[model samples]
Target: RAVLAAAGGVAAGGLTIGTAALLGGTGKGREPGGSPPEGEAAAAASEEAGTRAIADPVRRAGHLLRRAGFGGTPGDIAEFASLTPVEAADRLVDFEDMDNSGLEERIARANFNLTRLRGGDGRPGMASDMRAWWLTRMAYTARPLEERMTLIWHGLLTSELGKLGIPRTKFMLIQNELFRRMALPRYDDLLKAISRDPAMMVYLDTIQSSAAHPNENYARELMELFSMGVGNYTEQDVREAARAFTGWRLTAPPRVQLPEGASEAERRAAQDAAAEAYEPEFIIQPRLQDRGMKTFLGKTGPFGGDDIIDIIMSHDAPSRFIPVRLFREFVHANPGPETVAWLAEVWNGSGHDIREVVRAILKSAEFNSEAAYRAKIKSPVEFVVGAVRGLELETDFRATLRFWGPMGQTLFQPPNVAGWPGGPAWLASATLFARLNFLDAFLFPRGRPLRVEALLAREDAAGMVDEALRRLVDGVMSEGARAALVAHAESIRDPVERAATVAYLVLASPEYQLA
Candidate 1:
């Protein structure tokens, strides 16, 4: 209860600070200050009208890590702090060069149960296993941006397990792997691929769509939520695109041939075995396709689903819309037209290559600006995964799976087609408690040993407090907050308890609440 009260106080204060940051209030990053730091003059000169470059290397690197990937550890921060802003951006954006075999090996050693896990009654455990698998990847992947971009695609190119039951849940992992593989591909190519994605076909009713009676769900979301924002396309466009996307289907499992007079249990086991063996692949039935010319987005053609995607990719709206969405994900909300226009130019110039656009955004003056730092709230996944990565926690990630739903952002289970509402919606009172409760479970697991030995190694109470703040919150806190944390720490007698208490307070602090 005391911990909850502290979290509440810090949360209220953090919200005020976050709200102020959003409403154009100045932060330490924005204080009328010294001439732009040594190497940042050119970058500062290029800043958009209202934005200023972050001059401090530590803060700049910290901001980049939180936005570009998940949050970084002290070693990660130290390594990035040594690089120039452009170098740092390159390191993260060009992450294909990084050796991630360690993470792969870790995953293999973990031996996650991606297949069926049966309890007493033979209920499938794939959903929980899938969630643990993804969270573990987010927490421990060597190429953080890979997982981050995978998450972006998952949320934007939304699908849900709630709709796809246990029998079909494996498709979600297939879709997830697709996102990771094509994490930084051309927008058109990704759209074309997702059009045939088995999970997407099922999620948006694309499998049910036919030439005679087309389902409009995928088409509407493709334009409104996925590619182009609302108002860029119309009902006519949706109908046409739906017709163009007809006949999409997944390969079916081989029929189970049960012996005559077999019990219901035997039949059920055989069916489950078949489902487990099935590997979904996209296929098109020519008879169900609408090969006739149809007008879409002001152009008439005998367009298939890929053709519809190609057209959307070529449209002016997606060039702007995709950049705006990426900017919101990596920088902040409410980006000005000039910034969007600049990003759209990168999008168009690179032939809708997402890697080029992400590179431009990461290296841009706007990304490192004071306006972008701590400008957005962390989603629950970010909150948990960032903590896990930042603290270097070691677990299979099974325990953390249950907390995601209560915190309102479950993997493969977005509430609807639009994905999580995000931003301020993540910090509702109930969800806030859920986050704190997650920290409680994470920091103090019942049977496991405490995970704050490094923190406890600090010489004294103040050192421990500062270490926690530094590791989790970029080492900067208001004097009052710092003093309060130190005082709280000093009062605790046991070294282990003292370290955990301080760590909890810092993690619960409003400063840590924001990315």
Candidate 2:
């Protein structure tokens, strides 16, 4: 285990393990209001609140895991706290949580499935039904981060919807393999995998690329979007790199559907559209790849696709890009130079060991400090799921849909693949309204998977609310937050329901949005 030096933060390991601690009940000694947690801000707030910050380790670990991976149920969070940040992260990066079925099983069940067909459209074979179901099933799967990584990679390497001909099936294949399998691997491997994916080939028009007619889009993105942050690669590099990828179109044949009932005219129109969508494939006249030596960022390549990949991955710029994004995720959006410099050094030195980048951030002073806890404004995806996690909502298929659908988020369906704009993009008055509605909908999760009310009744309302707050917000709510919730509970008759209601209020609060 390669380790980075921790300067006054986490030890060599991220976990601080011991016998698991039991969460306190709402015995009279349990404070009703949530004061700030201990550390810098807590020390300051203590002056005004007249109470010390309570160190709720479980809540702290829960906050860390949610931002690092998917939100955890209360029990899951407790177990998570027992593991150091590295151990917990190992489970996440290894995709250990995603053992629903073997890859072969995943491939077999989805092999011949068709997603959509308008009954009377008379298209030869309909597939919209199969595609929608695929997306929906992925949404409900327990491994949200793996899926989330696939979604991110898809945005970065977007394919056109219409041109994929059998877009639905091909899309599922790329998602299941490239992104899911390589989600936690080194960035170099992921970039090459994207270059090989049939869906990406079609989407980026690379499949049509030939020695004579090179496709530059894939090459341009290889530097501009994927590896080096934009502006590091030149027009000269883009032109030469495109030459490297000639003759790399999709190896798989297009799935031609013959939906019944359509006239010849309708089929012709569809075929025309498909042809246009796939024109690059059939027409990439062969061109000679640049055999003369070329250079990209100081590395010369008498290059083929492999040489181009070698040059691209060896660049220092990507070292900065990968960790900067990772820091924004594990830490917060604006990681100061000190943090990025430290993380970038680790990434570059470790040959882009992704786990190293994650470990450094998790153990850094920032991750555990009071300011870092609950600092990110949860995106719609996190907010919805985190609320369900806090309430221990038993979620099923439709229940999962309600999480992102109501908030105008559709994961892989983000408008135009630049990815649903993160941070401010998630906020709008309308979206905020949807967020509130979504939280209330939780206690009554659509599929009714878990009887949330029954669970809450087992514990009094205020106490359960406190537990929910500890898990969701990392126990950072203000004293005013608790009082406001308690006041809201006064109107409800049953203590359990009132407690659940209060949990809803805290989960819905704006504070939960931050890291």
Q: Of the candidates shown, which would achieve the greatest TM-score relative to the real structure?
A: 1
Clashing pairs in 1: none
Cα RMSD of all models vs. native, in order, equals 4.4, 10.4
Q: Write the per-residue lDDT of candidate 1 for residues 207-258, one digit (tens) a residue.
A: 9999989999999999999988988988889899999989888877788998
Query: How much is 5 displaced in model 2, in angstroms?
Result: 46
Each model's backbone clash number: 0, 36
TM-score of 1: 0.92
Query: For residue 418, what is the lDDT in candidate 1?
Result: 88
The regions of model 2 sitting more than 4 angstroms off are: 1-56, 94-166, 252-295, 298-301, 399-408, 440-450, 453-455, 494-500
lDDT of each: 0.80, 0.57
